[model samples]
Target: MSVRRLADDQVQPAKFAFNRDFAAQAKVWVSKYPKGREQSAVIPLLMLAQEQDGWVTKTAIEHVADMLRMPYIRALEVATFYTQFQLKPIGTRAHIQVCGTTPCMLRGSEALMDVCRSKIHAEPQHLNEAGTLSWEEVECQGACVNAPMVMIFKDAYEDLTPERLAYIIDRFEAGRPQDIEPGPQIDRVFSAPAGGLTSLKEEPKPAAKTKAAAGAAAKSPAPTQAGKPKREGESETLGTSRPVTPTDQKDEANAQSKTGKAAASRSAGAKAPAAVSDPARPAARKPAAAETVASVAGPATPATAGLSDRSRPAGIDRPAAPDDLKLISGVGPKLEGTLNSLGIYTFKQVAGWKKAERDWVDGYLNFKGRIDRDDWVRQAKALAKGGPEEYFKVFGKKPR
Candidate 1:
């Protein structure tokens, strides 16, 4: 980088002030910062001065300093440090900044610079005869992906051939720069391949389901027996065998009593006393069917019992106007739809969930602990109390 200094004293203007329109814009920029830190507006104010006068004059720098109540040297340091601020007069129509970094150079940026030298002036930063065009070779302008580019004022013209750049220069010189669009000047879309996609050309197909998975999905939940109200524990059985109920237990007890009475009658008629087991040994009892099934199944998962869990939050019908659940930070349109499908449609409903209910919801969504992490209940509470205004007041930002 070359040392950047102000233009000669002879060329410097005697005084400087923002025009009426620029003064209003400067005020707006300053207002964005806190009162005591209005100095943060220095960069924008200097840029506005350049947009109005075509360059950052020394007077403009001091004027901006005074407006922001910052030291003149602090403002000068900003102007001189950023290359975006031009210290000398440039082309009245357009000042072209050609990228000369490695990527641009490897892609023929030298040829583009040669075109600029011949068309505008022999040296960089020197104005053409008509004072309507100038060119400067600058470092990367953050468009390396679209290399061999030129930035005229704020717009970038990328993917440039020497001839294309020449034509662009002519257009700007004729005061019709807007005729040419910015970005790549080729048969390409933004930084994409020049012709078309080279990989992943075929659309991906969804994975085919295996026979077992297909059969499992096709099978619906077993229907409850007719003439019986579904028991509380029965609904949580998933696709396994029906759970042992209180009615089943009572019937088993009655059958055992009848067998005992029959055994007593047989013993009364027996010729000899029935054989007794030795005191030191005990007979092994057979495991009940329920016990066997329980051992095989291990334990019920959340998905199996989610619908019948006591801790699950109570859901209500959709109101005349449902609260926009998307207002919560973590709930997008898709998540809002999922919540609606569960009959959750109001902020008050969400806010009322206890920790157990929250865990149920978290498990239902497979969200681990995201519900607690995002503080959805608190967010919902704020919205429930007074809508967005209250939410923003509590959180210090607008609801997502």
Candidate 2:
């Protein structure tokens, strides 16, 4: 939005000179944006002017306007907007900038303000009669823990009791070098540990659904006949699953076995112990399976038939497990979720794409040469079940 000219201040030239090295330095600010955006560099250019002169003057504003091709009024607008630049003349030697935000205010910042009024000057931006000190109340300085603090130029002096700030002010006025001390002057650390934490305890593993507490088999089966992969009449589609059965004496053996595999580990070092039988006393039967599942989100139908052949993504041959289709390399959890939602769950689906479909996924997913990078279809087909276990074969070559 375009700003209006101030009713009080006029578009006059700056009183101070923007020196040789300073003008050269000002060009660096203009370089940050694209061409024709040089006008956008107004704030920084004015700042450069303020740095050259103790406060921005009419001559400095005019210099910045000319340098950045901005109007003199527009340059003054930029100068007046930021609190950092002082528009009035300042002391030749020192300035005390006291913080007035809530934390600093709570920590006796008012006392520091009092000190400024008593020892330096009473108003926000005026120099003392001696011309060696000046003070103003400002905002949070990113050092909230060191509340009740003041800044001298850019360096913060924190944890002020009125006495401490008085001492600091005196030292600055006396031409003494105030070397910064390590750590906060106050008792608090950098940031407090986050509150409402509910998940840090070392939870015990629930008895495995397939094993007992000890993982030893309970009553070693009055062995019943086990069902094979199903018949022609069976449901082929992955269906909504049954509720969880809390592990009992019977599933103990599976627990001790700890056979669950982390597919990504890909080597022997990744495997856990074999399923073991339970030796503990028998489990007392209690609540139904329905209750167990409600404790957490109930399981949905297994993703088995999610996107097989007829339902295959337009250009890909198979489901794309998320990790493979990242925006940049090293895709993490969020990118994987995006791929899964787009129904591009496996490498095969991503690998195989029609030009149009590839464009849609790339644009929809906002992913940047994804489809044409590799022959997704052929590669995916190779990874297809009953095809030559190509996923393992291809990704398996440990590069030299």
Candidate 3:
């Protein structure tokens, strides 16, 4: 790692203190640790400071150190050690961190850096003339599969071309960064194959009927001997008049050993009494095919069969002007199309979903618990009650 130091003295503030909200948040972070281990909060406190001021100043570092009751050097060591902390001021609107790791480098990260240099500034970590756009080349951002990516704030724009990067910079500069969706810029779903799935294309068929038939056959009773009464648990052996008793079989073997005449012993032993079944005992049944499958593989995913209509949110005719469901954080373009397909065209429809309805939609999307986690209903309610103004007021930021 390169030596990381604080900004020049002229740029450093006279002093620092967390604001009221940040102070409360700092206390919450500090409380997460034991009494004497408040120093463990130094990293989070410095991060909170950076989020508030847009960069970590020397004063902010010292302030965090004081709050945690640790030596200033200890806090400074942490801030300098982690590249996440911005020791100097960064762009107020967007800071593009280009991933220059091996994967990204092989995938045209150098061209991305060139675009940043030409558009934002001649050098990394420098802001544009407007002070709203800045960029720097950094290590991997964990999207190697979507390599040659650039991260603006928390969102990554991947599979980038120089032209696309230029267009993105312009959008951010124009104060409409949300116009460009995050993730792969091309036709890709997360890290999936860009041209669609290459393997597992065929849907799995249901369990074969042959297995069930075999199970049924195994459960059926065995055939009885010809011209003889069949008894429970009694089975016939070929070429024998009756089932041989253990003692008769042993005597026949002894007779055969002494006289070398097994045919006579067998003839004598063939007249032994048949074996009987216990009247009180019930027969054991083999498990059905479905039961056997369930025992081995557990239950099938509920999403595969889908949910009942009763749990589905009611649909409506497409309105002349439908609400943009994409504004909801978790709902992307593809997700919005899916919602539209389900007749969910307005925030009112989404906001009205009961827990069961939400669960149905969640299962249909195979989103696990993301719907609840993102609070889609609450976001829909806010957007439905009032437009973006209300959503911004409620969420303390613009709707995604």
Candidate 4:
């Protein structure tokens, strides 16, 4: 860290006080901490001062010190420690901080600095001719992936070229910084591959099924074993299914009779089930006797095989232990429990959710697109494959 101080011989006003709204906000901030820890509101109070005066002035720091009942130097110590506070004056409209770290340096941040020189003062912290724009080169803003970025006030503008930076400066000088969007300047999501996703591009789409597969699916009976008798001690597996009893058969018959004419009419128009094909095979000679294993498996579900509303997802099994879903950036303990309740107990399950399923979950949880915003699918995919190592390799950082 470098030395930070107020301008020498700079005279502060005789008195300073926050406006009505800021005074209320300041009290709210001070009230957040314990009784004796009211001084902990120093940082936010300093920020409030900065926002009011557009920079941290000597008088503003003193006012904040008075508000917190701390020594004046104590407030000065904090104001100078954080680079976020501008000790001196700034451009009236905007102060741009260009990132000059390794990533931005490699991505032509020097070109941005040159643009700043031509537009604003040759030295940073000095206002332009119109006194509306100023710029300084700073360290990385943690947007290394979208290199060559600059922050104007509170918002970051990334993936900048010299020409783009020039345009941004012009807009700010013209009192119209809102004209520019604040992230990548191309058709891409934040920090994603510029050419689009490289891995995990195989999200399932509704593909047209082959004729054979479609016919096979149609011919598969919904009651292949429906009428079969359950031997002693047989049990049901599907929650909604049960063995047919005499009472059930009688009720079904009565219901059919009630709608017999409509049923006949509908049956006349319904398409016939497709035929099944078997390939020719030669008979095999029997040699050894094989022992049969008794299945401890629960009762089968044949009536609801093709009905998605009644069928469980194929090959999906509840794990003996759930994954740590809180590893995802936006997921906390409460969110992890919500996902578990939704049957998303594994990284693979979260990774496999397509847009439709994600939308459903997002709506159910009232997250409103937070999944896409945090790129949860991408994170879950990496976690599902190789845990921490894969996550680090893919994202260039560890999972949360």
Best by lDDT: 1
Task: For candidate 1, give the lDDT.
Answer: 0.87
- How would you encode candidate 1's per-residue C-alpha lDDT over 83-184 as one tens digit per residue? 899998999999999999999999999999899989999898888999999888888899888888989998889999999999998898888988999989
TM-scores for every candidate against the unseen true structure: 0.54, 0.46, 0.63, 0.53
Ranking by lDDT: 1, 3, 4, 2
- What is the lDDT of every predicted structure here? 0.87, 0.62, 0.85, 0.78
**By the TM-score metric, which is better: model 3 or model 4?**
3
User: Clash number for every model?
Assistant: 0, 41, 0, 0
- Tens-digit lDDT string for candidate 4 (1-400): 2356685444455556898756766777787789999999999888878877788888888889888899999999998877788887788988989888999999999899899998898987778887788887787789999998988888888989899888888888888878988888876788999979989888788978899999997876443244544443333222134576676667767777878977888789977789655468556565443322223344554342222432222234568987899988899888887677656788988898777767666666667689899999999999999998678556644587
Work out candidate 3's RMSD over C-alphas. 9.9
Q: Give the number of colliding residue pairs in candidate 4.
A: 0
- Local accuracy of candidate 2 as per-residue lDDT tens digits, 1-400: 1232222355344256668766665666677779998998887777777677777776777777887787887887777676577766666666877888999888788888898899887776778988888877777778786677777765667777888777777777777745544335555444433242346557677664765634554644333223334343332232213332444433644544554554335575566789675778565678788888776766664333233334434533244333344422234558667666665666556545666666555556445655456444545554553233334334321111
Which is the better candidate, 2 or 4, if ranked by TM-score? 4
- Candidate 2, superposed: residue stretches over 4 Å from native: 1-14, 181-183, 187-400
Top TM-score prediction, candidate number = 3
- Winner by lDDT between candidate 4 and candidate 1: 1
Supply the TM-score for candidate 2.
0.46
